[model samples]
Target: MTKLTCFKAYDIRGRLGDELNADIVYRIGRAFGQFLKPTTIVVGGDVRLTSKELKSAVTNGLLDSGVNVIDLGEVGTEEIYFATSFLKADGGIEVTASHNPMDYNGLKLVREGSRPISADTGLADIQRLAEENNFPAVTQRGVYKQQSVLGEYVEHLLSYINLDNLKPMKLVINSGNGAAGHVIDAIEAQFKARRVPVEFIKVHNNPDGTFPHGIPNPLLHENRQDTIDAVLANKADMGIAFDGDFDRCFLFDETAQFIEGYYIVGLLGQAFLQKHKGAKIIYDPRLIWNTIKLVEENGGEAVMSKSGHSFIKEKMRAIDAIYGGEMSAHHYFRDFNYCDSGMIPWLLVMELVCTTGKTLGQLVNDSIDTYPSPGEINSKLADAKTAIARVRAAYEKDAVSVDETDGISIEYPTWRFNLRSSNTEPVVRLNLETRGDKKLMTEKTEEILALLRQ
Candidate 1:
């Protein structure tokens, strides 16, 4: 039996061939089928060169275990979630590495209603089944069928936003040559039919596994400038960018100022609460988000969950929350099976701007000012645990509160910071935020880094 190194606490991801391959993926399919015992499974893949081959291997394994596969080829991750719930599939899997580097690819799995399958869920069972190399035998193999769910997906997404009163606007969209381009055409077709009066200036809007415009991740400061430049040059109202699989999106205002995901969370939370008063909203505790304050102020309940896609989705389902958002730009919808949709966040934000007669900049500016954040910083530490412990000891005395839900989150009256070890690499991630105090945030960030180094 071949060993798998990249099976993390949640999904399976690693450099191609070294940690994942056709044979191992085949075994994973059998393992997943054996674990879930689903009658029908929805499978989809991104534009990565390896995705098709991996999907084939996974399908064979599922068939061998007597589980029928509905293949939605070359679709985004959220589309699989849409198909699973719409088609009433027993489970689903999306073959994607998300915004990881070009050399890596992997799988995101879920069960009925698009519920996530994580380490605490069925991932451990799948891992055990894969490691044992013994899959369930069946008398007959299940069938495979190919379908395109993009049209239905677009319609489903539009249902969340009011298209009736959307005003005339020009927007810049950079797909980064990822999987988003294929579906953007469908969405644009619908917008045109409805006469939304929005002109889309597209850049790098092609599905290329080679990533000619570099990786599609906008969280990196250097990668966001192209979209910002396009927005400024075209004089567009806003700019939207997608990650590799288009499962998360990042936005820039009319002036090309990058709108932080934290502010977007608050903005979207407010939008949702307007219609569903007193609805529950879930957020991750990576930063001291003013989104919680905004939600509470608006007569809605705010619940904090641990970070990560799997954790947020699970909590959303458990609490029956109306919306769930992460500071990293992942927004999960109750309608979209509570799975994160990189496509819908921007659409809803556009609707918010159009209906409210405010620019994206105006909607987020106040919140950004209220809770300034240091932005996530990653450090390649010699030992993550030791570094975290040293920082914790240094701040323990002054911290008004300390919690290790995700990592070491130390809170002071004016500022707070969360330092957690990365699941996939030997690095520690630090996220700090303040109550309108930028200098203090910077000073405390430096102080924590210095202590970690010592």
Candidate 2:
């Protein structure tokens, strides 16, 4: 039994050959099958070059343990979620690294009803069992079969919006040479078949394991310029970019301005609240002023959750939230089994634009102006804990409120910031926003940076 180092707080991720390979993945599958003891499971993979071999090994492990496997080849992370719930499978696994670099791969696992399998849930146990690598084989091995859920998944996405209400708008979609191309093509085909008035201008739309156009991470400023440039050059109404697995999507407005996930959260919250008055909207603690204000003004309740997807989904399920969003571009919906989807967000945003007859930029203009933020900033430090402590000590006394929800969050009347250390790296991330004071936001951001340096 080899001890694996890829299991993380949320999911599994690691460098290709050194940390993860077919051997390690097979052990993980056996361990998962032994631990969860599911009768049947759904399996899928992203477009990563190494995912196929790893997925095959995982399937073999599950089958050897008498767990039937349903294979959905080359799919997005959300597709695993959908297949798990839609097919009523006992569990699901997607071989993906989600926005990680080229030479990395990982797995996102979920149990019945697409419930996330985090550290607290069942990942730690699986990790321990995989390390032990002692699994008694079943007398009868399980079976493996292929299935395509693309049509059903496309139908699920279209269920979010009324196609007749959609206006004739041209959109620039950057698949980032990842796994989103197939699904995008599926949806476009449906639209074309129905004569829906949506025009899609695709770039880097083909799924390439090599990632010839880079890793498709829109969070990086350098990675986002292509989408911006494409939107401008095509004169499209808006632009959307998806990560490797297409579970999260970033948006750009008609003006070629990148819309931060903070404002998009507010925008999406408002969109849902308009239909379901007094519905609960879940948001992370990193940036809250805009989301809180929008939810309350629209007759909806704003609930705050911890930073990670597991925490957010748990909170949403508990509160029966109609919608939940993170500043990192993850958007979850109640109708979508409380799972996040890169495809749903853009579809809903387009619906809003079509119904309101407003540009994407115009829809979010008020919120962006009302509460400006510098976005989340990260700083590498030798000692992140000491830096966090120092920053807390300096601001705690003068702050109107302090929250330790996921990290250290300090709030004053005009500005607020959250300082937290990364779970995966030796870095502290800072996000600050103000109630209409960009200058104060910038000043406090610098002040926080100085404190971190100290």
Candidate 3:
């Protein structure tokens, strides 16, 4: 049995040989199966080279435990979540590192109805089982079967948007050689058949394990320029870029200006509320989103949640929220089992534009002005806890309210800040926002960073 130190607070992730390999992944599968005692398990993988081998090991282990495996080969992480809930499977796992470098790989697991399994839930149990290296052996092994859910997935996505009477627009898409290319292709084909006048500009649209361009994470300002450039160079209506497994997507307007995810959250909330009046929308507290205000004004309820996919999904399920979003570009939908999807957000936004007779930029420009935020700045610190304490100490004297749900959050009258330590990295992420005061936002950000650096 491996030590399995790679089992993180959220998922199992590690460098290829140093921490994870087929053997370790096989044991994880056995442990997961034994722990859940799942009747049927759904499995999928991204475009990484190591993913298929990991999937094979996992499936073999599951089969050995008398657990049937439904293989949805070469799909995105959200697809696994969707399939797990849609098919009412006992559990699901997706082999993906999700925007990590090529040498790293991991697995995202969930139980029935696409509920997340985090450290507090069942991850520790699985880790303990893996460490024990003992699994129940079944006399009769279960069977493995291959299935193609991509077409149905695409169709279901289209159902969320109205493609009927859409205007002709050029859309730029950079897949970054990840798992999103084929899904985009499938969706584009459907749009074509329905006579939706859309032209797709595809870049790096093939799945390449080496990630010749780089990791596909669009959160980095450096990684987003290509998509922005493509939008401008082609005079496209808009551009969208996807991360490694296509679980998160980023957008650029026709003018090549990157649209902040906060504004997108507001746009989506309004959209969802238009259909389902008074429905609840969930948002992370990192960015003091005016989106929440917008939701409330639009007669919808907005609830603050801790940052992270697992927490957001759990909160969404608990509240029966229709939609939820994080500033990191993760968007979740109740229809999609509250799982984050890189594919759904853009489609819905596009549909919003087509239905409203407005351009994407025009739709979100107002919200950007209302809620100016210091887009998540990360500072590497020697001690994250100390840095957080320093910031908290500075603000606690006159703070309106302070909460430590995920980290240190101090609320003032006009501005607020959340300094959160990352789960996987040695850095404190700072998100500051003000009630339309850009200068105060800048000053507070510098003040907090200076305190941390001190």
Candidate 4:
């Protein structure tokens, strides 16, 4: 069997040409078809230059396996999820590297109802089958057709907000030259068609696979300044930026201060609680106090799940949670088939701003003040486990509580931190949060880092 290194804990991603080319992707498509034996599958890709050809190759493989394919041309990852469930397709695949460098490309797969196909959930089986590169001959080939889901997708997104109350607001939207621009354009047109007031100041709005600005990853501190600068220059009510595939979005307040994803989790949770007071809200275990406090304060239940889309989505479905959020900026909605959408979050926040007459800053300022966090910090070491063990041992004595759902989370009376090892690298991630004390948060962050480094 030919060894393949592209498969990760969650999805398939690797450098282009060398690790993931048309031939390899074709085999993956065949393997996926063979493994699931689905009658119909949905396929889509991001704005990467190679995505089109790769998607075509994969679609051909699916067709060769006698599996019907619905091609959603050049879309965000969430679109595949939306189309899969919305079309009632048996399976789906998205050809996207999502914020990786230009030289990389990969896939994200989901089974029926858009349930994630992670390493534990049939991805490994598909990987092994692809590595074997063996397939049985089929007498007939499946059919293929190109379908546009943008109109329906826009209507679904609009369903999340009250059209009447979405007051005319000036907003700066930066697409980072990724696949998000098309959807934004569609939504803007929908707003205009409905006569709902919304003014969009678009930046890098074109879908450029070359990523003229940079890869659309606002998670990196360096890539955020452009969006922040645009928001301030335009004097917009708020700014939203999305990753290459647009499944994850980062927000900035009217003042152009980049809001942490941890706080956004709380903000969005509160927004949902307004309509469904007793609903359940799932959050990652990395940074919990803010989300937990907000959900509880609003007469909702807060449940903590391990970080990662598969786990978050699974927990959300299990508990019938209305929403799930990760501090890394992935927001999942039950209404969206338990899939995360970059579009839904900003719209909800916009509605909140219009209805409450509050700036984005005002909405999340209290959460930021109440739970100050030294956003996720990382350290590369020869032995990540040893580093995590060191931190756990050091804090085990003083911690009032410890949870190991995803990583080692140690809680104190007024402060807490979660030290987790990366799934893809030999590095440890540290996130520290304190109850209304920036000084203590800073001190604990450094103190924990010192121990992690030791």
Best by lDDT: 2
Each prediction's Cα lDDT score? Answer: 0.88, 0.92, 0.88, 0.92
For model 4, give the 10-residue run with minimal summed lDDT.
Answer: 419-428
TM-score of 3: 0.97
Can you tell me which runs of candidate 1 are displaced by over 4 Å? Answer: 136-138
Q: Please, what are the lDDT tens digits per residue for candidate 4 over residues 1-454? A: 7799999999999998879999999999999999999999999999899999999999988998999999999999999999999999999999999988889999999999999999999999999999999999977999999998888988888898889988888889999999999999988888889898899999999999989887889988889988889888889999999999999888999999998899989989999999887999999988999898889999999998999998899989889999999999999999999999998999999999999999999999998999999798989988888888888888899779999998899999999999888886667889889999999998889888988887
Determine which window of 10 residues in candidate 3 has minimal summed lDDT.
365-374
148: Cα error in model 4, Å: 0.7
Q: Per-prediction TM-score, please?
A: 0.97, 0.98, 0.97, 0.98
Residue-level lDDT tens digits of model 1 in 1-454: 6668768888899889779889889989999988898999999999898899999999999999899999999988888889999999999999999889888999999899888888899898898889889765668899999988788889898898888868899989999888899888888989999888888899899899988778889988888989999999999999999998898899999999998788888888989998899999998888755988989988899999999888888788899999999888989898888889988898889989998899898888887778888788889988888889888888889889998789889999999999998876788999899999888888988998888876
Better of 3 and 4 by lDDT: 4
Q: Which residue pairs show collisions in model 2?
A: none
True-structure lDDT of candidate 1: 0.88
Instruction: List ranges where model 4 is wrong by over 4 Å.
Output: none
Scored by lDDT, model 3 comes in at 0.88
Superior candidate under lDDT, 2 versus 3: 2
Regions of model 3 farther than 4 Å from truth: none
Residue 258's lDDT within candidate 3 is 90
